[model samples]
Structure formats: C-alpha cells, structure tokens
Target: MIYLDHAASTPIVESALNIYIKSLREDFANPSAAHKLGKSSMKKVERARQLILKSLKGSKKDQLIFLSSATEANNLAIKGIKLLPSDRVHYSVGDHPSTSEPVKSLNSQLVEIPLLEGGVIDEAKFLESLDKDSKLVVLSHVNNQSGNHYDILSLGKKVKDKFPNIHIHVDGVQGLTKVETNLSSLIDSYTISGHKIGAPKGVGALFIKDGVEVETQLHGGGHEFGIRSSTVNTPLILSLCEAITAGLEDVITNNKKVKRINSLMREELEAADLGITFPFSLDDTSPYILSFLLPSISSDIVLRHLEMKDIYVASSSACSSKAKGFNAGFDAMKIDQSKHKFVLRTSFSKDTTTEDIETFVKEITNIIKEIKRL
Candidate 1:
C-alpha cells in the first residue's frame, strides 16, 4: 500500500523500533523508583532529554518536558500560561486544533491573526493586533493541511521586538526534525510529536525556553521537572530520542529527496488532466505535504476510493478527518468554503518513492474516470 500520510503519523523506523524493544526489555523499572534498576532507567531518561534538547539547538537551561502527545503538550503550553481577562491571545484559526482549541479555551481576549493572499500571516496586521495586553501568540511552524511553512523565527523576533514580554508558542509537531529548527530565545515553547517523525505514538515533548514557566497540567509524582506529572515511560522516551536523532541526522538530505518526490507527484497529477490544482505553492510550503483540490468530487469520496485500492491519503487533519461542516482552518487560509470538501492532502516521507507517486496518480486518475462514468 502507498502510505502518504506522514503528516498524520509515520511508521517507526527500524532503529527506533529496535531501541524501543530493547528498552522495554531492559529498562522495565519505574524511573521514579529508588532502586538501582530504577536509577539506571532514570539516567537513560535524562540522557534522552539532553539529546533531544541538543537536537533542537536548545540550551541546557531550557526545559524539555515529555508528555503523552502533541495535544497534551500544546494544552500545557497554552492553559498553563498565567493570563488575565484583560490579556489578549493572538492565534490563527489555521493552526491545528491542538493549538487553536487550547487558545480558545483561555480566558484572555482572543484575536485572530489574518492571512495574506498566499496563505501567509499578515505581518502588518499581526503587528497591529498586538497590544500591551497581548500576552501570548500561538502559531504552527508547518501547517498540517496546507503545508505552508511560516517563518516563525522572523515572526517571533518581530513579536519580541515590538512586545518584549509577549510569549511565542509554536506547535512544531509537523516541523520538528522535518525542518531546520533552532529553539532560539525568541520562542517560548515548542511542541514535538514522536509519531510525526519515525517513532511510535504515545510520546511527545514540549520545549519551554529558559525563564518561561508554565504551570503544571498533570499533578502526580512531580515528573517532567514538575511541568507535567506522570510515570515516565522510559522505553517510549528512548525510542523517541532515537527517532529524533535519526530524523535530524538527514534533514537536509531527506528534504531534498522529498522535494523531488513532491515535485514528481505534482507534475504527474497535473499531467493526468484530472482537474487538480495545488493549494499551496511549492516555493513556500514544506515538500513533505502536498494538498490539492480535486475537481467536482468530495475528497472524502476520493479518499475511500483510494483506500479501496490499498492506497492512503487524507482529506484533512487526521484528528478532524471525520468532522463535517465549516472548517475554520481552511477559512483562515483564504480557501473558499465552496472548495473545502474537495481539498485532498497527500503527505510524504523520505521513504515515499517516485513509483509511489506515479501509482497514486494513476489510481486516482482511474478513480476519477470511473466515478465520472457512473
């Protein structure tokens, strides 16, 4: 089967899988235990934390808190922030629900960041939206649906330059190890997911910059530096660190390879004369995800047809794939409501080969033909 949903979740690489199995066998002791075996497991967990922080160019003073998933990490970063009713939180509706929903839940006055014609954040208007009361701004490094890569570093710098105290939180689930990320001082908190890169699910982390204190979301044994509390899963943490190391090792090379694959898919799909139009431009978006509009067909219908052929793609974020009605994210990206249901997203990994794209285009072409005939 051609699996082109890496943006949603990816199969764990062999190295990470091996490390997971090994850790499960050897590091079975509770990390919180006072026994020697537990101490050994705790040491491994600390090593994993340092390694992950270094991978993101994070300094030693920064805190890397492991959590259940990106959703939880995002929640901690958002709801944990101390906000007053008069404070304003700036966020785009285009962000993943993990980021957007939490911002909405906050008691602060919510301001929606507008998008330019090309799905870029409106810089001038964004600056105008901020005030002395603006406390936090939530953004996505790489958009899950449209693949638009926002220049968060520059944007964060802009935010800090104007409002020195406004915190910047990034949902980096789709960007970590997939893009060139440096957790500079400009960003206050960033989220990373294991499954997005080549590790198993049920593990993710939040990088809180030094001096940014987020209140504890989960209260238990005071784990994750007291930012998140739970029995730490050593095996999952080791495997996640291994996957992150492997993914970061070849970001430039993997990106180049995936760019070719993305180009091939776009070219072949365009060549099929299937009335497909790419929503995001290749020049600006991540090569890892390609979203297009399928003419005269709901992407959900096309998705089922593709699934019947043992191929997989996505019509929207996997979390909300089953949801119906108006999509706030699409609307924020300037996507016409009329064409929202027709948009199909096919994301790639380094393993996605040219043949996979060719077969996908061929099968999708046939599906469209078959549907038209019916």
Candidate 2:
C-alpha cells in the first residue's frame, strides 16, 4: 500500500527496527535488578536517554520521562500541573484528543481557546483566555490534522510576560523531526511520540523544564525520578534513540522535499477542480501534513475509496475519528458542517516521493469526478 498516513503512524525505520531486535537479544535484563546484567541494561537506558536529550537539544539537567505514547505524555503534562489548586488550564480547542481530552478531564477550570478558519489558534483569543489563575497553557506546536505551525516562541514570551508564573506545555508530536525546536528557550513541557518519528510504538518522551514540580501519575518502584513509575523499556528506548538520531541527521533536507511534494499535490488538486480548503497559509504550515476539506463527499467514503485503491490516508486524528458525532475541529474553528462534510489529511514522510503524491492526486481527482457524476 502507498501510505499517506504518516501523521496517524509512520512505518518503522529499518535502522530502528534493527536496533530494537539487537537490544532485545543483547540487553535483555530488568533495569531495576542489582546484578551486573541489570547494570548493563541500565547503562543502555541511560545512553538512550542521552541520545533523546541530544535530539531535543535539551540540557543534560532537564527531566526527560519516558511514557507509552504521546497520549500518556500529554496526560502526565496536563494532570501533573492540575494537582496544584491555583493552576487553571488553557488549551486550544483544535488540539488532539490526547491533549484536549486530558485537559477537559481535569477538575481545574478549563478554558478553550478558539482557532481561526485557517486552523490556527487565535492569539488574541488565547491571550484573552489567560488570567492570573491561569498557571498553564497547553498548545500544540503544530496541529496534528492541519499541520498549521504556531509561533511558540512568541506565544511563550507573551504568556511569560503577562503572567510571569505561567507555564507553557507544548505538544510536539507532529512537530518533532518535521520542524526545528529549541526546547531550552521555547517551552516548559514538550511531548513527543516515537511512532511519529519512525520509531516503534509504545515509547514516547516528555521534556520537563528544570525546577518544575509535577506529581507522579503512576505509583510503583518510583522510576523516572518519581515522575513516572514503571520498569524502563530499554530495548524500545534504544530503538527510539536510533530513530531520533536518523531523523535528525536528515531532517532539513527531508522537510524541504516533503514541502515540494505537498505544493505539487495542491497545485494538481486545484487544477483538477476539486473543492479544497487549505487551512493554514502555506508559509505558516509544516510540509509533512496537509489537511483539506472536500466538499460534496463524506470523509468516510473518501477514505474507503482510497483504501480500495491501495492508498492510505486519514479523515481526522485517529482517536477522534472513531468516536460517533465528534466534531473537535468543527467545534474549534466554527466551520460549517454542510459545506465541508469531509476532512482529508495527507501526511508525508521522508521516504515519500513526488511520483507517489502525483499518483495520489490523480487517483483522488478520479474519485471526486466519479462521485460528482453520482
């Protein structure tokens, strides 16, 4: 299958897979054990941690906690802060369910920031939502569906200037490897998923700024510096480290290539007269993901049609698409449901090529024309 669903989950890189297998065979020991074997495993985990820290450009002193997925990282980031009685939470309505759902579950006051039609959080609305009680603002550095990029530096500085005490937690799941992040200067807590960066699933990380106190969600052997408790998965962590290293090595060149492909896809779709809505201004979006509205067709139908042709894509965030009558993006952007019944998200990986995008555009145009005839 020609997979255009990198945002949903990327195919594991061969290097990451090889490392995963080698580690499982070679370093298979409980990190918590006291024996030499255990110490060996512990050393591998620490080395993996160093690789992750380096990829993020984070300080050695910064806290990096491993979790099962980006969803878990987001939960820890949101709930950990809500433990404080004075902390009010603000998150964009357009955030993935991993973020918005967790923030919604918190007992703390939840403020929803509106997004513009371009799927960007309205900075003015975001500022208006902040108050003295607002201790944390959770924003996605790049939206999962629309790929719209946020000005995290400006937003972080603005929030800091106004509240001084406010903390900004950025969900960087979509941005990792696709965009450059200077964690030291931009954010307090950043969430990343291994699967999105061509690593195996079941491993992710959260970057906690130094001096930030967050209560542990898990209770056990007090692993992860008591921030999270579980036996560290050394093999998966090593694989993740390998993936990150490989991703970072060629990120700049890969990103430019993806952008060029996306531009060509858009031009082709427009030429074919397909109804399209480009959410973010091209200049303000990431190259990896492109979300558009297809008028007069249901997203479900489009997805199924594409699948039948051995092409894979997504209608929305994988989690929310499963829910009945969920309209997270529509609710956030106040988009008219009738004018846009279907949302198609095409995500590209470094391995994707211009020929692949051209085929996708041609196939999709044919599908649209057939639907129009009906």
Q: Pick the candidate with the highest TM-score.
A: 1
Worst 10 residues of 2 by lDDT: 332-341
The candidate that achieves the highest lDDT relative to the unseen native structure: 1
Give the number of colliding residue pairs in candidate 2. 0
Models 1 onward score TM values of: 0.98, 0.96
Q: Candidate 2's residue-wise lDDT over 294-330, tens digit each?
A: 8668878989999999999988878777754457666
For residue 73, model 1's alpha carbon misses the true position, in angstroms, by 0.2
Per-residue lDDT of model 1, residues 68-99, tens digit only: 89999999999999999999999989889999
Cα error of candidate 2 at position 69, Å: 0.8
